[model samples]
Structures are given as structure tokens and as C-alpha cells.
Target: MLFTPTVIKNLLKKPATRLYPFTVREPFPNYRGELYIDIDACIFCGTCARKCPSQCIEVDKEQGLWSCDPHACVYCGICRDTCPTKCLHMKDVHRKPMTERIMMVEKGEPPKPKKKAAEAAPKAEAEPKADDADKGESKKADAKKK
Candidate 1:
């Protein structure tokens, strides 16, 4: 008799869970869901690759390529946090289900090589002023006399 009443009460109560696929819940604010990169801003410094615990990120500075294996990624946001250029970002929504494996690759312009000190030194030496030249000659003449 007691069990009958309990069962009746439970049966009359609404379900505890929602229809998940039909009614998706909104993601929480600042949720790290999906990883993405702004290729233009990336410096290919390999900081992200080095910091990734899963080792899913790959960077080629010479080729200016940044690639990530989403299947191997843990979505922990470590790569995003370590990026020097602030190019890495995470969206609020998670990545969609995929039927096949795919690589996330981004190509950008490589950083230009820095000028060598040896190349710069000659430029400075070639630009002597007339007054400076006269001073140098006078100094040499005085040294010869001494």
C-alpha cells in the first residue's frame, strides 16, 4: 500500500533530464570549448607546441605552418595560454562530431631575417662628414710630428 502511493507520486512527477539533442543547453561563459588560431598574428615561435601536454600542435617556422591534431587534443587550453602572439583562441561551443580525422593547418608569412651587425658596420663607416675627415687628418699629422 505504501509502495503503491510512492510509485504513483514518482510517475506523476516530471522527468529530471531534458531531451539533450533536441534542447541543447547554452555553454557557460568563458568556457574553453574549441581551439582556433589567428594565423596572421601567429609568430610560429613553437611555444604552443612546446606547452601542449598532448603534443598535438606542430609548428614549422621555415614553412610558416601551424598544424594541430584535434583528435589528439585534450582541449585543456594550455596551447592557447602559451601562445606568445595571442593568436590562439577558444570558442564557447565545442567542436562538432567528425566522421573522419582531419588536421587543422594554418599557413602564414614567415618572419624576415634580421640584419647582420657586420653588414650594418660598413654603412656607418662609409658616411664620414667633411669636418670629421679634417679632424682625423689633423690628429694623424699631430701624431706623426710627435
Candidate 2:
């Protein structure tokens, strides 16, 4: 009991606790961090859903959608790799807040029609010259002679 008390007193030289949030640590290069979904690029492929070990990614084709519950994700990065369109990317970002809504594709919304490309301003049409017309006629006469 006497030795334990003496050892404890000496061990408390300085507090080793680090102030988190303020003192951020860099994650490893291979560290699978937060997942970001690019909804527009996603092709409704079920590969992400099938590859997810935790079954966190949900891909409903009939409804044209994919959604993942970050709470259930294990950060394996499988969902990011298996996506064919390269829509899913793993980013080293801050954790999602509880107030953030989960991603889900909306049903019954008609797909927006593709916008017609802007028409390039019409180029000024060249006026046909009398000399050019005469040259064309002579060329045609020469070809007929052959």
C-alpha cells in the first residue's frame, strides 16, 4: 500500500490529455474516411449495395435510387470501389452531423428533358460573285468536253 501511493504521486508529473477538435490528427493515406455520394453520376447500379459487407448501402432499382446509412457503415470503402460510374468517392471529411438528412432518390419525379444545346450564331453567308459563277460554268464546260 505504501509503495503504490508513492509511485502514483510521481507518475502524475503532467497531464497527457490532448484537446481534440482543436488538435486534429491526419489520417493514414489508406484510411477509409467519410463517404461522399455524387447522386447525378450514380447509374443506379446495385454493385455498391451488393459489395457492402454491412449491407449499409441500399440500391433500389425500381425506384431509381441508392442510399446509405452512415450510422451502419463500417468505412470499408467497398461501396466506393464497386461503383462502375465512379460516382462514389471516399473523402477525409468531418463526420456527418445528426441533423443531416440521409441520401435517398425521390420517386415519381419525371426525368428532366435534356436541354437543347445553344445554337451557334449563324455565320454570314458569302455572296456569290459573278466571276465565281463564270468560273464554275467554264469548269463544267471543260468537264463536258472531256
Candidate 3:
């Protein structure tokens, strides 16, 4: 048969199917797989948590805490879409399987920028105080000329 070469080539090639744990197929560009939060950009506004249909997200603005349940999330991406700061991300990578039911929580504040000592020193003591002396000398010189 003329199909003999095609059959031989297909047989020699690797199988299309792969073991899941060993190899993961790349997710499509639009796949909504998991949630990621950029804590610094987040204003502790509670908007995303309020918009979640499943109520998986919990925010305590007073305590500066954010918590989410991965098991409870449906990956519908409503929270990501509603974020005012666009701090939430619906990534294409799936959440890893977990044996325990644990709340994913992040707390506290974003790190503050450090003030430079060199900049502070220049601000405090850089004035020359020579203008007043220059003005007095100029007045004496003018009186002498008169």
C-alpha cells in the first residue's frame, strides 16, 4: 500500500499523550487558572473580596489582612476583573494540588522607602550666609565713591 511510509513514520514518533504529573501542557493564553495578588498595589479597598461570588476572599482593612481559599475559588475571574488597582491576576498556570485545606493569607504593609542620609545633610547645612556680608561691603564702597 502507498500508506506504508506514513504508518512507519507515525509509529516511530513519540506518543501524543503525556503523564500529567510528569508533564504539564502549556495553558492557553486566555485560560483563567489561578489567582495572584500584588499586595503593594492593593489599597486594602475590599472591592475584589466583595465582588467574589463564592465569598472565598476575605479582607480585614483594619488589621491589614487578606485571605483567600483556593478550594472555594471557581476561577471565574470576577475578582480579578473588579480590582480597582488591577492588583489581582488570573494567571494561566493552575494552582498546585494541596492535601490540606488552608487559607492563603497576606498581612501587614508594603515596605517603606528608605531616606538617604546624604540628601538630608545637604538640605540642613548648605547655605553659605555670604549675601549679607556682600551687601554691607557694597554699601561702604558706594559711600566711599560718593
Question: Which candidate's TM-score is highest?
Answer: 1
Tell me the whole-model lDDT of each prediction, alpha carbons only.
0.82, 0.65, 0.76
Span of 10 residues, lowest total lDDT, candidate 3 = 124-133
Instruction: Write down the worst ten-residue block by lDDT for model 2.
Output: 117-126
> Which should have the higher lDDT, number 1 or number 2?
1
Superposition TM-score, candidate 3 onto the true structure: 0.62
Q: Give residue 20's error in model 2 in angstroms.
A: 1.9
Tens-place lDDT digits, model 1, residues 1-146: 76999889889999768899998888997999889999999987778876787768877766889999999899999888878778999999999999999999999996754567657754563454344446657966997999
Can you rank all candidates by TM-score, best first? 1, 3, 2
Error of 3 at 107 (Å): 1.0
Question: Model 2, clash count?
Answer: 0
Write out the backbone clash pairs for model 1. Answer: none
Per-residue lDDT, model 3, residue 110, is 36
Local accuracy of candidate 3 as per-residue lDDT tens digits, 28-51: 999998898888787776787768
Rank candidates by lDDT, best first: 1, 3, 2
Model 1: residue 35 alpha-carbon error in angstroms:
0.7
